[model samples]
Target: MEPQKINKGDRNKIYFLVIVIAALIGTNAYLFFKDRQQSERFVTVSTEKDKLRLEVEKIEVELDKVNALNLDLNEKLVEEQKLARVKIEELKAALEKNQITQGELDKANTQINELKTFVKNYNDQIIQLQKDNIFLKNSRDSLQNTLRNISNKASNLENENANLNAKVKTAAALKLQSAEIIAFRTKSSGKKVEVTKSSTAEKLSVRFNVVPNQLAEKGHHNIYLRVFDPAGNLLADEGNHFEADGQDMQFSHSIFINYNNDDSTYVIDWANPKPFIKGIYTVILYADGNTMGKAQVELR
Candidate 1:
């Protein structure tokens, strides 16, 4: 079979068709590549945004760690921390947008760095404050030791002076007169009813009168109470101590009252933590480094 012969008009027509088809193919290829590049760029931007978000989270975690230390922060450091948190929140808000431009991303990055710097400065200040506090504590302890040594060196002479002072204080000390103690059962409605039964007694009601003394200083005084069970065990809370007659003594409760150098009546209501036992309970009162009075109550 003979090959088909090409004429000028037909040949031109064929060339035109070929050119049109090639142009369409090129246009389609260009559009496809452009769409693919745009998709890749979007994915890269999203990934970077996520990474930035994670970095912000890390910074926030660091801030939380510092906050958990519970250090007493000064005014400046507190304000700096507040501002850092605000900046972090702002960055987070900006990054939450659906589309972030490169410029916006760069800006966020710069803000993040500033936030890091602020946190570092805050932490440095906290460390310095801690060091200062430690130094102050050590200085206080050293001064206390030196004073104790001086006190020991003059012990005998101080004792004679203290003895004279004790005589004077004893004369001026407030005394509890007509001191009385009674047991009571407190109801859920907060009413107290007198009770002599050990199983029903929940608290003790103490009443006393302060004897007038011309030598006593008229001012506020702390009246300490000491309760003893039948077993001779002092009833007191843990670490409840007061200074009495140059010695540390345990007491159940202390009351603050005002004295006008005249007879004044006072009351102290004490609730026992443990149930009352069927025995005698002794109540002693002290003020101004001396025993004021003692009273006893029995529960059957």
Candidate 2:
């Protein structure tokens, strides 16, 4: 019975030791788990902090870029404003020049109208001068005939004396008249020469009258015209003997006419195939080597 009690005591001691060892092992495992959980939490926090820092840097860079773009836009706006100012000044200058040109045109129109009126009055004076010239010529011819008849008579004294007195009377009746150009006038259709957008040709109509010079030879005389562009270059003509002031000249066109013992009116039509630049144009007319008239026109 003593041996059995001792074996039972050893068995109880072994069991108690095993229980203590188990308790120590459980404590160590609990500490390891807790430490592992803490490490995981720290890693998570560090990763979040890095992400937030990166987002802040990205925001700062975007703000910087926006600032640069704004500066560039401001610079462009300033340049645009300068260019706009220059354009405005140019437009203002052009408007002023146009106004001045309009004023000059009005003055020229008034002068041309006055010239037309003067030419009409001059025509009337020319007709009366022609009649006076004819009467003077007849008186001179009668005096010449009386002188011839007196030269033939050589015999009777009183009869000769009376013939001399009659010849003297006829000589006193004779008169002299000077020949001159009566008047000249030109008229144009006030309508502008229209160049259609799709067409290259244009038509011009001009009308004029020739003043009578009673002493001038009654025959055919050549007439001419010259058209000039705004650039002062002569327009081309396919037909016409181009001469001006007894010199060969480049002309737009020419015409021939017979002025047979009367005042005359003339109208001419001209066709232009060349493209015209937009500006003022001039037309000069010549008759019998003399400048008869001129006209100005504008095109837009």
Candidate 3:
């Protein structure tokens, strides 16, 4: 058998076939590598986006905790809590897109971390403020309690003083039961004769019985007598004015009676320098600065 001779046309056809096969392989390899690179980049973006979303969720939770504080006492923190929630919403919005850049991710991560720090600091501040409030409240309560105690003590002292004053007044009071007044003229024979004619009357006698009281002190007490005539003038024989219980009053006469916490009788005499003429005469007896008894004597 004889070897066949190679032609240029056949050789060119073989070279062209080799070039077409090589182009098909190169195109298939480029498509495969490009698809794999796209898948890997998508996975990275998804992972970063998920991470940012989770961070946002974390921030939301922290915001809820911060907002849980007492609003009345911590009203100043309301704005801070709102701003944190706003930041969380921004993060959520940023992650909502199907695409994310490296710079956006970095920014989100940093902001999330900063927000966490802010939340911690704000929470600590709120707690400290609340503690201060408690301290102030307790201090106010203590002050109020002290004032109340002082007021109560002062009231008790006043009550005690009032009781003491009442006791002193009771112990110092004197009572008189029976009172008698007689108008008569003394005879020249050194004897006493009762007379009802005021034109000839020469003397006036006053008598009273001191009531017994165990509470009153035993002492020589001065008794003042006020005698009023028909002209409404006090029959003052010695002094016209007498002081009783810080009041200056005009009295007719006075006598010292020795009291021993028992019933005692006393008689006092008053002399008229002039002729007495009256329709009715009133006699008021004063003991311990108070009017104790009174009596009337009638004369024609």
Candidate 4:
């Protein structure tokens, strides 16, 4: 009935084991807290991608405003719009794969910067255009006043018409070299042959040429086509809408041309929703809000 006494070495070993266990537990707790902090601070891929997407949407909205103004008569703004859209697509693809990296984020930001710069430049140009227009208007008024004083009203009106015509001529950014539309039959064999009768018409092949114009701001151009039947029904395909002079309008089809201020050819095939009728078909071509040309065909 005597209490057992522990050896000194055994007591020291026991103390050492207790200290080791306590140290291990503290280290593990510290590591767990540190990892939790890092996880809380981590940004997700979707967040970054959403930020990029918002930037793209911003750029597109600005570009749309310019387009609605119908003052972006060149391809530069359109090209910027295209580039922004391309970046959005890339971001979407990366987000789908969950592989969006910091580098992709940086690239998307770069595109945003470029698009913003473009928007600023476009706004500046628009302001300058407005200033020029005001100057022109004031000059016309002064000239009219002088003409009235001198009884040269007829000459004053002629001068005004001339000025308007000059603006119109300069506004014709792209000139037409050639344009044609040929009706074709799409056979059951998936072969095509030129057809004359509307009954045999499967689709209309539209072709046109952009003549070189050094004055035209060169890049990518969106060319629109409006096909009208005898009853004036618009034949539409993709790119069936456009904004012209602050008015929304519908177009039949559209194609893009990279006009390096050089002659280039483009074509688009249109298959109307309804069969062709035996009547006159009119096709008009427009580029950057300016009508390049028009032609008509008699379908018998």
Predicted model with the maximum lDDT: 1
- Evaluated at residue 2, the lDDT of candidate 3 is 92
- What TM-score goes with each of the models? 0.50, 0.31, 0.55, 0.42
Could you tell which candidate, 1 or 3, scores higher by lDDT? 1
lDDT of 3 by residue, 36-88 (tens): 99999889988988977887787687667655764454456777887788888
- Please provide, for model 1 over 163-271, each residue's C-alpha lDDT reduced to its tens digit, 9 standing for 90 to 100: 8888888888888768888999878898889999899998999998988888889888898999998888888998999988678999999989888976677899888
Of candidate 1, the 10-residue stretch with the lowest lDDT total is 114-123
| TM-score of model 1 vs. true structure | 0.50
- What C-alpha lDDT does candidate 4 achieve relative to the native structure? 0.77
Q: What would the per-residue lDDT of candidate 4 be over residues 81-196, giving only the tens digit for each residue? A: 57756765665565455555667677767866776787788678767867777798899999988878777767777898898876766665676788888999877898999988
Using TM-score as the yardstick, the better of models 1 and 4 is 1
Look at candidate 2 and tell me the lDDT of residue 99: 27
Residues 220-290, candidate 2, lDDT per residue (tens digit)? 66667687777887777655565545577656777777665454666666655566566666777766555
Model 4 stretches with alpha carbons more than 4 Å out = 1-172, 237-239
The alpha-carbon deviation from the true structure for residue 271 of candidate 3, after best TM-score superposition, in angstroms, is 25
- lDDT ranking, best first: 1, 3, 4, 2
Off by over 4 Å in 2: 1-201, 237-241, 261-263
RMSD, each candidate, Å?
22.4, 42.9, 8.3, 34.6
Name the weakest run of 10 consecutive residues (lDDT summed) in model 2: 174-183
